[model samples]
Target: MLHSRETYQPSPSFTQPEMITIILLYLLIALLASVVGSMAGLGGGIIIKPLLDFFNDYDLPTIGVLSAATVLAMATVSLIKLRISKVAIDRKNGFIIAFGSILGGFIGKWIFNFFVLEIGLEQLIGKIQASVLAILLLIIFIYIKFQKNMVTYQMKNKLGILLAGVLLGLIAAFLGIGGGPLNMALLIFFFSMDAKQASINSIYIIFFSQLSSLILVGTTTGFGSYDLSIIWYMILGGSIGGLIGSIFVQKLTSRRIERIFNIVIVIMILINIYNVVKG
Candidate 1:
């Protein structure tokens, strides 16, 4: 009973030419975001969301599709690299997170289409994302200030991992993130995992989440106005970036690398928050 004309909404910012330009720009952005994401466990989704929001006026559903696409592409590259290195993911935790994230992804897409989109909730979310990012940045700075040596500490807890995974699922669904920064924070704070382990595990988490989210998106709202032709471009760029990042990880000390990289993330989050609010 859905009327095609009734359901169709016009894009305010992205004309056909603009969209093509944005797609091309995304190829470069994907490379940079993937490298930083892989090296620091910061994630490409957060980077893409703001860009899409600023340039394309992408709604939440569109952000979800684009976010999922970025995660899928980047995770696939990371998965292949990890396989070559013989890294083993915590399968139990990954599966638990994936299960919850898949359900949340579906619910999130439904919520966007049925409610948020109609109510201009995407604009509201932009503000909230800014606030959340600011808070997260402050927390990171505080953690670094008070507990610089926490990197040497190890607090492995399987139960805690499961709980973090569930929370991550919810956050990812809401924010269009792959839950990398959130997961990285948990691994560093609660689990006390080192940078190398955290980075490797993050890729594992993204792999599962991406697989599940992709299916949810495909079955739900479909890819809103996406030109499927450029998927190969994203894949190619993301793979090269991921490979370079993984190599960079091996060259750096885990402690120094983690602390420095976390500082960068904290800064980026603050900037994103500022931009979203200013918009």
Candidate 2:
């Protein structure tokens, strides 16, 4: 199924006007996703998958590749700006996790291939992944909306954090997200980082994981035929949005953004649930 040679050439049904509208709409959505996703420390990748699955005609593999690329664009802008601003980053640990993600991402691609080709569950896999992500995001959202005190753990579990990267990478490939939300949660809960620092770390975590996933996706998926224009739209939107979101987060404090983040997560959860049922 993944290796199907019957490609998507432009059809009369898939008209130029419709394509232009799609491009503009997706561009705006990606921009918003990156903006809020940056401030919220979720790296914008989480928002791309379910939304694209809902709206676009792209397949799961293409969706995954595009999601990773968009996240990469956003993360690149954010990280570069962070460097210019001289904000401190936990480089050593972040790189360690990224190193593990390299292998984990490849393994995840293999799993994705099996699911898509062997089991013929390409669309089903996306739906299942979206459903699980929605549930997890819902739990986090509920905790955020209701909990009075956010717990912060001591940063004593370096080895555990490093080991956790494997799962993060797997999820990065599986869900087409950079694992920003999960990384932020882990940092705050176990690494004793505040939401601000957690957001910073989450950006790097996303960078590494998404990079790995993108590399594996190209090789494994064999991007022979498909409209590549969708990718450029995502890149343009994600890049600009990432810069804006990074600046926004940096200018304002993360404490305020947390509430908005919770709300956004709830919205995404509802959207995912809808997609799951509809799919």
Candidate 3:
């Protein structure tokens, strides 16, 4: 079921100054998340979504929108920085994956709307998302921990690559995550990409998938009742974080980046698990 647009009114208890402070706090969180996300090629949304969910400041839909916007901003800036620094991406495979992600983005959003609006299961959806995310992160963490013993491939089949993108985008869009960890793991396993290469390509895939998802949201529900006041702050934080993270990626070795990725994944897993219980 489709719903009409509604404006979100701030709580009457929060004064103008208080609201500003709250927005600033969110900005700080976004900044920190973006830095870690960009450096590890996790696209920041994985961190942002669970943390925002923890605060319980906004509804699930609003949180999803905010996370998507911030991730898109971070990805844009990060890609630009990489380009300027002569970091080459696998454009053929990247674009193929991105095209598939766009299709997946559309389907994922439709499913989300169906559950949230049609079934009226917003809270349940949040819990489900958190639980699934936690489980997936745990699996990825385990895989990363013993990756040396696993058989990796150099997948060159375009159709397989496209299907992989679809699956990645579907999960990411549905969970309101930027699909960073999954992208990293899949890129490494299927394409035999090193950590640095996977990170760069992960951001590349995130940019297109997230952009498509946001476009679908805007075109269909027109932002619904999500808070817009903190959006500018999110953009500012994302841009700054993207710049800093890109520079760090350039300076750091692949081993160092993997260490950062592992640390962040563990932290995210804990946070998401808490969200599941709290929700």
Q: How would the candidate models be sorted by lDDT, starting from the highest?
A: 3, 2, 1
User: How would you encode candidate 1's per-residue C-alpha lDDT over 1-279 as one tens digit per residue?
Assistant: 111324646345556897688677877877877887777666677566656565555555655666667767777777777778777666666666556556655555455454455555656766776567557666765664455565544445655555556667666666676777766666666656666677777777776676677776565545544444556566666777777776666667777667756676666666677666674
- Candidate 2 — what's its lDDT? 0.76
Q: Per-residue lDDT for 168-254 in model 3, tens only?
A: 888888999979999999988998888888999999999999999889888887764566678889989988998899999998998
What is candidate 2's lDDT per residue for 129-217, written digit by digit as tens? 88888987877666555444766566546676567777777766767777877777666666666667778778887887888777765
Q: What is the Cα-based TM-score of model 3?
A: 0.96
Q: Where's the lowest-lDDT run of ten residues in candidate 3?
A: 4-13
Off by over 4 Å in 2: 1-13, 143-151
- lDDT of candidate 2 at residue 92, scale 0 to 100: 80
> Model 3: residues >4 Å from true position, as ranges?
6-13
Candidate 3 global lDDT: 0.87
Q: Give the C-alpha miss distance for residue 121 in model 1, angstroms.
A: 2.2
lDDT assessment of candidate 1: 0.65
